[model samples]
Target: MRYSKFLLPTSKEAPSDADSTSMKYMYRAGMIRKVSAGLFYYLPYFNMILRKVNFRIRRGMEKLNSNEMKFPILVSQEILESSNRWNAFNKEMFKLKDRNDNGYAISPTNEEYATLVSNLFVKSYNDLPFSIYQIQQKHRDEIRPRNGVVRAREFTMKDAYSFHADEKDLHDYYKLMGEEYTKIFADLGIKTFPVLADSGAMGGNMCHEYMAISPEGEAEIGFCDACGYAANLEKVECKDIYSIDGTYKNKYDKIETPDAKTIAELMNMLQMEAKQFVKSMVYNADGNLVMVLVRGDRNVNEVKLANFLKATNLELATEKEIKSIGSVMGFVGPIGDLQNVRIIGDFEIKGMKNFVVGANEKNMHLRDVDACDIKCEWADMRFADENDVCPKCGAPLHVSQGNELGHIFALGKRYTEVMDSVFVGNDGKNHVPFMGCYGIGLERTVASIIDQHHDEKGLVLPMSVAPFKVDIIIVDTKKENQVKTAEELYNALEDAGVPVLLDDRSERAGVKFNDFELIGVPIRVTCGRSIENGKLEIVRRDNGETVEVEIANAKDFIINMIKNY
Candidate 1:
């Protein structure tokens, strides 16, 4: 590739809307252009890198005995409905109507389509235990798609699904896929931690997510440095509540709290730790007013709460709804004039000796209330934070943010039973096949790579995914000797099976070098006046190290440097 013929738009000014390092560098390097809030256009330069990444992934997948296949981007709604994902997926799924008023959707995922394909072709157990993967576009209506490609409504994904006749086969394939994922990330030069994760709508028991640690990440993971136990915060478990030593005698009473609404206000007014106060909230779960109680210091993990209630729909009750229920916004509690609402309390609250709770009346609260007197169902309904002790090892949990690049789910019989994907055994008995899904967000992975490998200058692409392996720069393009020598060296590098970019533009040496660094071409060959003296300079983009080499040996030197990178 020649800079004179290519669109290498490099800018020193960062976009005002760029919030992350990857977004800023990608924009400055002209690798991607934002079309909408969560939509982007990948330029040719970035597309080249994407192609190389896809090649690596496909090569590894082939070695794992996985077949590459492409599925339709637009799928009929009937298939999704049959799999019970149409409603389960809800608004996050992009749906549309075709000319015949038939419902369709831009595939958010191809689990249903893959299952349908398997049902059409696969019959007996002999056809089982095969995996197919595809690199294709996926659409999800993210409520808040911020941080550029890290969370996007439209993006590329590498999704693979494996079918097996039995649980043993599924487990074996899952382990193999895990190993392959480790290798994939290793090949991309990223060290990732596979943490247990909640499958969410994917409907699986055992799931793991490949997380790349980054402060800009949205997902919160709870990690115990002492025990090395890590899990997504939504799934993190805490120890059982400490037993209370004594019983309380104070009767439930309402007192004026006076304009104290938030937990902080209540804590400040009462001058007590949040652990000593009860946080009561009203939730509308499937049109039922459910009173949820947690320690004031702890936040609610809505996923855990929803799963506990076994409710399909749950949301915080609106202020208006709360007012209609005969309770003020700030002073709501479980005890009040009798109502049909279900009251649920956190397990920790049950062990609390004497605590303060909302009075369910305006500007009032009940202090030193006994849990034995309070009547409610105890549940693990709150999020575990840094202060919480790990249920497994008793180590304090440390919270860190991470980006989910890949997720593997051990989906056992959920979809297969619903879709009637069955197999016959040697004993002639019909059995549902076990299923597993593994997914990698292709664009997010690229964004995460940039997030991890960039500096103030620009993107510092890992050598494995760089668009070009080497960039050849003529320090003085106006000098015919330098230009000729650079061109010859570039050709030689290309002949040596290295992807080389020739900076033949009329730009100054500083501009060319800056562009090369911004784009993160791993190796650079500088042909200047020194080249006329039978010497050339090789610069590494990652570290600003320049090595002088004889002009005759420049090709081998560049190739060797790239090999090491």
Candidate 2:
């Protein structure tokens, strides 16, 4: 690629709306242009990066006997209906009506379509195990797009689905797919950690996500420092850290606590520790009023709460709703028979003896209250914080944030059973095949690579994914000897099977250097006044390491350097 002929629109400033390192660099490097919120137009340079990453994804999928296949961006309503995803996805889906009065959805995923496709081919027991993959566009109606392509509504993804004759076969193939995903990220020069994830609407009991560890990521993961037990924070669980002592005993009593609406205020008024209080929170769980009790210092994990209650939606109850249940604002308790309101207690709350709680009266509280006197269901409902013990090992858990690069789900029979996707068994009877799904977002992966491998100068793209391996900069294109030498080296490098970029533009040396660094071409060979020394300089983009090589051997030195990168 020649700089004079290519669409290399490098800039000094990135978009003002860019909030992350990759978002700023991609916009400044002219890799992608935003067309709307969560929508972008990929330019030539971005296309190059996309192709390289997609190639690695394809290579990894092929290792599992997966064949490449393409599905339509628009899936039919009937297909989604068969799998019940059309109703399950609900508002999250990009649904529209066609001119024929038929509804369709811009597929968020292809579980329905993949199951239908399998129904066509898997008619006999011989075709019991197989996998198919596609690199195509996926759409979702994102309410608020953030972090550029990381949360975009429309994007490209490599999605693969596998089918097996039984659950055992699915589990084996699932393990193999996990290994393949790890290798795929490694091949792209990106470090990732696979952690247990929740398959929310995908309707699977087992799923894991390959996370690119970073503070700028959108997801949080909790892992053990002593062992390899890691899980998404939304699904993570920890052992109870609070336990009851042997000696103390208490009887419930009411106390007057005036003008103390919050825990902090109540703590100061009564001069009691936060751990001595049992706080109650009211929520509208799918329109059913419920009160959740926990230790004062602990907070609730609403995701866990909703999952436990099997509720589609959960939120803090409004003041009007709270009063309608005969509970005063900021003074709700679990012991009252005021209404049919449900009460849920955290597991730690069960062991708490004679703790403080609201008296369900204006400016009042109850102290020395035992949890046995209250009627409620108990479960693990608090978020795991620092110093919390790990569920796998008894070690203290460590927490970190990461971006989800790839996710694989062990979808046992969600789609296969609903869509009637099955095969004839060897016993001459039909049996539903188990299913698995794996996905990697192309743009999100590219952005994560930049986020992981960039510096102040610009993106230090990996050799495998760089737009060009060697950037041959003809510093001072007016000099005949320098231009001629650069052209020769460019040709030599290209002929040696290197992706070379010839910067024969009439730009200044500083401008050329900055542009190439911003675009992050792997190796840069500058031919200028240095050519008078019978040598050219090879500068590494990642580390700024410069090596002087003879003009006759410049091509070989760069090729070797790139091979080592």
**Pairs clashing in candidate 1?**
none
- Give the per-residue lDDT digits (tens) of candidate 1, residues 5-105: 88767788768888787788888988888888999888888788778778888887888777899998998879888987777776898999999999999
lDDT of 2 by residue, 410-491 (tens): 9999899988887889999989999999999999899989988888888899998986998899989899999899888888
Q: How displaced is residue 388 in candidate 1, in Å?
A: 2.4
Q: State the displacement of the C-alpha of residue 195, model 1, in Å, after optimal TM-score superposition.
A: 0.5
Worst 10 residues of 2 by lDDT: 241-250
Q: Runs in model 2 with CA error above 4 Å?
A: 240-279, 353-356, 361-370
TM-score of each: 0.96, 0.92
lDDT of candidates 1 onward, in order: 0.83, 0.87
